[model samples]
Target: MAASIDAYQREIGPTAGQGTESRDGVLSSPLERLSALHRISQSATASLDLDSMLMTVARVVRETLGCDACSVFLFDPSSDTLVLRASIGLNPGAVGRITLPLGAGITGEAALRREVVPVVDAVSHPSYVDYPLLGNQPYRSHVSAPMALRSPDRLIGVINLMTIEQRTFDSEEVAFIETAAGEIAVAIENALLYSETDAELHNRISQLSTLRQMSRLIASTLDLPQVLELVSRQAAELTRGLAVEIYKAHPDDEHPPELLSHYGAGDDVLTDRVRHQVRGMVDEVVGALGTVERSIQVSPGQRVEVMALPMLTGRRAVGAICVYSEKHLGDDPEFHGMLHAFSDSAAIAIENAELYDEARRGWQRTSALLQEMHHRVRNNLQTVAALLSMQARHASSSEATVPLYEAVGRIRSIAAIHDVLSSGSISETTVGVIAKHVTDEASITTLPPDTRISFDVDADDVWVSSREATVLALLINEFVSNAFAHGFSDRSEGRIEINARVSDDVSVVEVKDDGAGVPDGFDPGETSGLGLQIARTLTESDLDGSLSITRRPEGGTAVRVTFRSRRLPEDTIT
Candidate 1:
C-alpha cells in the first residue's frame, strides 16, 4: 500500500516532502506538478454556480494533494465571519453549518494574515479549533491558505487541507495550494457579482410592481381619510417597515402636524421613544417641505432608522409619510427613489380629495342660500294674496269683488310654484305637484261655500323647469277660476276635472267642468274677461303653447292647452 501510495503521489505531484524517489526510484518531473495545478485551476472554474464550483474545487484539491480532507470557507462581510461553504472528507452536514469569526481559529488566522498557515499537529496547535459535529478524524497535520485577489486586494475566503498522518508540506506544495486558492477566489468574486446584479434587478421589478398596485388603490377613492390610510399601509409594505405614519400639515401654522393614518403596529405596542423620534421626523419634513431621516437607538446595541418624505402638490406641503425600520434604509438610493415615487402619488390623491371636499361644501352653501330666497319669495306672494283677499271682502260692489278675488287667485297660483321650489331644489318640480297645489287652493278659496264644487286633478309625473311650472300653474288657476265663476254659477253641485298628459316631448292639460257651457259663439281670443285673456296670453308667450276652449257635445266646457315640455338641464336638480 505504501509503494502504491508513493507511485500515485509521484504521478500526481508530491504534496509532502518525502524522499526524492518515485516507486521506480525515479524523480518526479516539474511538468507533472504543472499538470496537477492546471487540473486544479480548471476544477475551480468549472461552473458558475458557487456551491458546485466550490465543491468540485475542494474534491480536486484533496485528490491532487493526497490529503485526507479539504474544505472551503466563504467570507460573509455582513456578519464578519467565515462560513463553511463546501467540503470533502469532513462531515457533509457540517459543510454549511460551521462558522468562525475573523481571528477565531486556524482558518480565521490565515484569513486575517492573508497568508498560508501550516500545523504539524493540529490537535496540539495553540490556535487550533475543533468542531465535534464535523466528526473526529484524528487529523494530525493541517494547512490553511487565504484566498484573495491582488489588483483590488479583496479577501474571498480560506481553503483548508487536513491529513490523518503526520506530514509536513514543502515550499513547492504550499505554492501550488496558494495558486489554486487564487483561482477559487476569482471564481467566487465573479459568482458573487452576478448574484448581486440579479438580486438588484429582481428588487427593482418588485418595487415598480408594488408602486403600480399602490397607485391604483390610492386613485380608487376620493375620500380623504381612505386615501391616507391606503397610502400608509402600502408605504409600510413597500419599505418593509416595522411601522408607518402619515402626517398632514395644517395650512395654519398655529396647529401642529396631525397624524392622519398609521399602519403596522398599534400605538400601545410601540415604545414611547420610537413615537417621539417619528414625531420629530414628521415635524422636520413638514416644516422644511422636504425629506428627513434619523437613526435612534431603541435599546442597547439596537438602532432603528426613520425616514420621512414630504407629500407635495406644486409648492405646497400637504403631508409627510414616515417609515421606521431596523435597516439603514436611508443609505439606499433605490429605497429613496421608490419612497419618493409613492409620496408623489399620495400627494396627488390627497390634493384631489381636498378639492372635492371644498367644492361640495361650497355647493351646499349656495343651495342653502337659494332655498332661503325661494322661501322669502313665497312668503311675499302669500302676503300679497292675503291683502288682496281682505280687500275683496270689504268691497261693496260684486263687480269690484270679482276682479279682486280673481287677482288673489292668480297671486296664490304663482306662490304655489315658489312653495314647491323652497321645499326642495329650486331648479325644477313635477307638473303633477304644481297642478294638485293650485287646484286644491282654488277649491278652498274660489268655490262658493253654499254650492258644492268638487275638483279632480290627474296630472302625469312630467318634470318641467321652474319657469314653465309657474306659467302652467297660473294657466290652470285661471281656467279653474273661470269655471267656478261662469260654468258653475247657478249649479248646486258641479265636477271640475283637471287632467294632464305628456307624450313625445309635448304636454296637454285639459280642464273640463260639468257646469254651464260658454255663451253661444264665445271666442277665447276675443274674450274681454281678464281671466281668459290672461290664460291665452300666458299659453302663447311663456308656455310656448296654444289654448282652445270648446263647448263639449255632452253639455259642459273643456279648456285644452298644448305645449312643448321643457326638461331641466343635466346639472340642474329636478
Candidate 2:
C-alpha cells in the first residue's frame, strides 16, 4: 500500500498520495479551491490554444474536486452535438473522439440547459448514459457543469467530474468547478474567433493570387479556345466549383451558341435538367446589361450555385460564361468582384481572338467579310430581341417585363445599323436613316397598342461610321423608349420627333416628344435608371458628346446630343 501511494505521488505530486492525512488535509482546505482557480486563470490568460487549455482545465478540476476522472465536451453548432475534447483517468485515446447529441445523456442535458447536474449515484440515475467505448473506469457519481458565456447563455461545452465512490457533491465544490468552466468558455470563444479570422484572410489571399493567374492567361494567348479552357479551370479552382462552362454566340449561327469548352468535372458536371436551367441563366445574362446569379437544384435536395456573366465588347454581348459550384458564393462581395474581373479579362480575350481570326482570313476579303459580319451581327441581335420578347411574355409583373421590352428595343436599334451595312452601305451611313429605324422600332415594340403614337424624322443626311451610327442609334432608342414609356403615362396620344444635321463639324441630334415633361427637379445629367444611364454613358464616353434635357416650350421634353464627326474604313471589322 505504501509503495502504491509513493508511485501515485510521483505521478501527480505529493498531494495525490491516496488516503494520506496530508492529501485529505490539502483537499479540505479553502486555499485549495483558490489555488486551483488561480492556476486555471493563469493558463487561460497565457494561452489562446483551446485544446491545451481544455486538457489543463480537465486535469485541474479532477484533482481539486478529488474525482476519479474528468472530461470536457465542447458544443458544435454546425452539427448540434457535443464533442469530447479533453479527458483524464479513462482511455486517453477516447479523449477527442466521442460525440453525443443534445439531451442524450447527463452531460448533454447540462449543456442543453446551461446548468449543473449533480448525480449522487449515476449508476442508478435514469438520465445517465453508459458508453463503454469511453473506457472501463466505473464511476458511481458525477457532476456535469455547463460551460457557457454570459449575456444570453451561449453554451460552449459541459465539464464532467466523476468519483469512484458514491457521494453527494456540496455547493462549494460545484461552485468552484463552475468557475473553472466559465474560464474554459471564454477560451473556447476566443479560439473560435481567431480561427475564423485567420481562415478568411487565407481565402482572400488565395483569391487574389488566382485572379493574377487569370489575367496572365489573358495576356499570354490569342487562342480563344485555349484561353477559355484555362480561365474556366482556374476560376473553378479558386471557387472550389464543380465545373466552369464557356459559351460564345457565333454571329453566323441562327441558334444560340453551343458550349465552346468546359473545365473541371467535364460534361458530366451538368446533367440534362441542370443544362436546361443553365442555358436559361446564360441567356438572361447575355440579354441583360450585367451579371446575374442564381441557385439551381441539380437533384432533390442538392443545389448548385451559378454565376452568369456576359462577355461584352463595349456595348454588345458576344457570349457568356457560367461558373458552377455546390456552395453559393454570391453573398460574398469579394468573390463577386473577382467574378467581374475575370469576366472582363475573358471579354478582352474573346474580342482579340475574333479580330485575329478575321486578320488571318486576309485583308483582300475584308470588304465582303465586313459586310457579312454586319449581317451576322444583325441576326444575333434579332435572336436576342426574340428571346427578350419571350421572357417578357412569361414575366410576372410589369416592372419585370418592362426591362425586357427596353432591352429588345435597344438591341434592334443596334441591329438597324448593321441592317444598313448589310445593304452595301457600311461607311457614310446616314444618322437620319438610323434614327428613323430606331423611332419606328421603339413605337412598334414599346408603345401601347391602343395609344396612338407617331414618329417623325426630319434632318439633313449626316453620315458617320458604322460604330458611330451604333452609338447614335442606341441613344435615340433610349430617348424614344423613355418618352413613350414614362412621358405618355397619363395620355392616350403622343408624337416623337428625331432631328439630325451637321453643325461646326459635329453631328447634333435632337429627340423631342410632345408628352408630359419630366419631373420639376429631374436632372438628365444625373439619370439613374438603366436605360437613361446607358444613353448618358454612350453620349459622354463612346461618342465623346454631351447630352442635355430641357422642357419643350409646348408642354413636352426634348433631349439633344452633340458630338464631333469621325470616319472609319468602309470595310473595317472589329
Candidate 3:
C-alpha cells in the first residue's frame, strides 16, 4: 500500500510548497493522512449494499479531507450521464435527482479526462456549474476526482469535495483522494455484480410461478376462444410486453393467419411497418416451426421488438403467439425456455379444445340419426297396430277379435318404449318412466268404458339399458293384460299396482292386482297362455332373471321378476 501511494504521488507531480493545513490552521501530518486513507478504504469495503456503502464512503471522504461537503456520482451507461448517488452535505433530495453529462461541468470534466481536478476558486473556474437546488454555499475551493478501476480499466463515477474557505489542494492531498476513488470504484463494481445476480434469480423464480399458474388456468376449460384469450394475456405478462396477439394458422398457404385473440391497446397505434413485420414473423415462425424475432424502427431513435413463437402440438404447428415490446427481449436461453414451455401448454390446450368441439358435433349428428330411426320405428309400429285394430273390428267371431286386439296391445307396448327412448337418452331410461308409458297405453286401449280400473306405479329410480327396458315393458304389459282379462272379471272396480326397485345390485319388479286369485292348480311354468309363455321365455333368456307368480293372501295375484342390475358407466344417467 505504501509503495502504491508513493507511485501515485510521483504521478501527480510536485506538491505545493506550503504545508498541509486547513483554514482553521490545523496541520495534517503524514501519519494522520495515512490513517485517513486507511479509514476510507475500510469504509468502502465494509458493505455490499450500494447505497449504504456509497453514503458511508462519502461521509468518510468529507471527514478525511476536512472538506465542508462531499458528494458521490455514479455513471449511467445507458444514458451516458453521471447520476448523484450519495451525498454528505448537499440537499438530501438532490442526491438522486441531479445528473451531469460528461464534459458538462467540473465533475464531468474530471470523469471525461479520467483525472483529478482542483480549483482554488470554484466560482472563477471556466468549467464550474452552479446548482441552486443543491443548497449552494459560498465555497472558494473544490476538487473532483474520477473513480476508475485498473484491470479492464473503466470509469465508474466521480467524487466531489468542496470547502467553505479558500484552499489549495496540494499534489499529496489530490493523490490521496484519487487513491480513495479507486477503492470506491472497486466496491461499486462488486455491488453491481451482486445486484445483477440477485435480480436474475428473482426473475427466474417469478417466471416459474407464472408458468405454473398459466398451466392450471389453461387446463380448466376446453372452450377455444377462452383458451386463446388466456394465452394472450399470460404471454403479455410473462414477457412484460406492451402487446400480445395470438394467430391461428390456416390450412391453406394462400390465406393469411387469423388473429384469434389480442391483449393490450388496439392496433390503431401500431404503424404499418410494425404490422407488416409481425406478419412476416408469424409466417417465419410457422414455416420454420420455431421462434422468430424482428426489430423495426418505428421512428427516429425509437424501435419496437417483436418475438413470435410457434404453438406446436407434437410435430405440428397449430398457431403462433407474438409479443411486442419497446425493449429487447428473447435473447437469453432461459427466456427462450420459458417461452417454449408456455407455448407448448397453449398448444395442447388448443388441440384438446378443437378435438372436444369435433367430438361434440359428431355426437349431435349421431343423436339426430338415432331420433329419426326411433321416430320411424314408432310410426311403423303404430301402422301395424292400426291394421290389427281394423282387423279386430271387422272380425266375424269374438274369439278372433280377442286375439287381434291382444296382438295390437303387444305392438303398442313396444312402440311406447320407443316413444320414451326417442324423447330423451337413446341408451337408457328409468324403469318408472317405461312403466308409466306402458300402463298409460294399456289403460287407453284395454280398459272397458264402464269399468273403473286405475293403475298405481311406484318405481324407485331404477335405470336400465334400452334393450332391458323393452323386455321389462313387455313383461309389465303381459301382467297388466292378464289381470284385466281374468283377475277382475266379476268385479266392477279394481286396482293394478306396478312397483320396481333395486337392492344389493339386484333389480326387482312386481305387478299385483286386487282381484280373483289364481286357480288351485295354476302354474306359471305350465300355463297354456301365449302371453305367459312369452313372459317366462324373456325373463329366463334375455333378462337373465327368474319370474314368479303367487296368490296374494288378500284375494289377489302378484307377479315378481328379479335380475342382476347392470352397472352404469361414468356420466350415464342413474
Best by TM-score: 3
Local distance difference test, per candidate?
0.81, 0.78, 0.83
Estimate TM-scores for all models. Answer: 0.66, 0.56, 0.82
Question: Which pairs of residues collide in model 3?
Answer: none
Superposition-based RMSD of candidate 2 using all C-alpha atoms, in angstroms: 24.7
List the candidates ranked by TM-score, beginning with the highest.
3, 1, 2
Ranking of predictions according to lDDT: 3, 1, 2
Model 3 TM-score, 2 decimals: 0.82
Worst 10 residues of 3 by lDDT: 12-21
Off by over 4 Å in 3: 1-47, 59-70, 89-91, 118-143, 161-170, 214-219, 269-277, 296-303, 455-460, 496-528, 537-540, 545-574
> Candidate 1, residues 464-543: lDDT per residue as tens digits?
88888889899989988888888888888898888888888898888999888886676899878778888888999988
> Per-residue lDDT of 271-360 in model 3, one digit per residue for the tens?
766777787778888889999888877777777788889999988888899888887895798789899999888888888888877887
lDDT of 2 by residue, 312-358 (tens): 77887778888887777656777777777777777787678767777
**Which ranges of candidate 2 are over 4 A from the true structure?**
1-35, 63-66, 165-167, 250-254, 265-269, 311-318, 349-574
Candidate 2 worst ten-residue window by lDDT: 14-23
Clashing pairs in 2: none
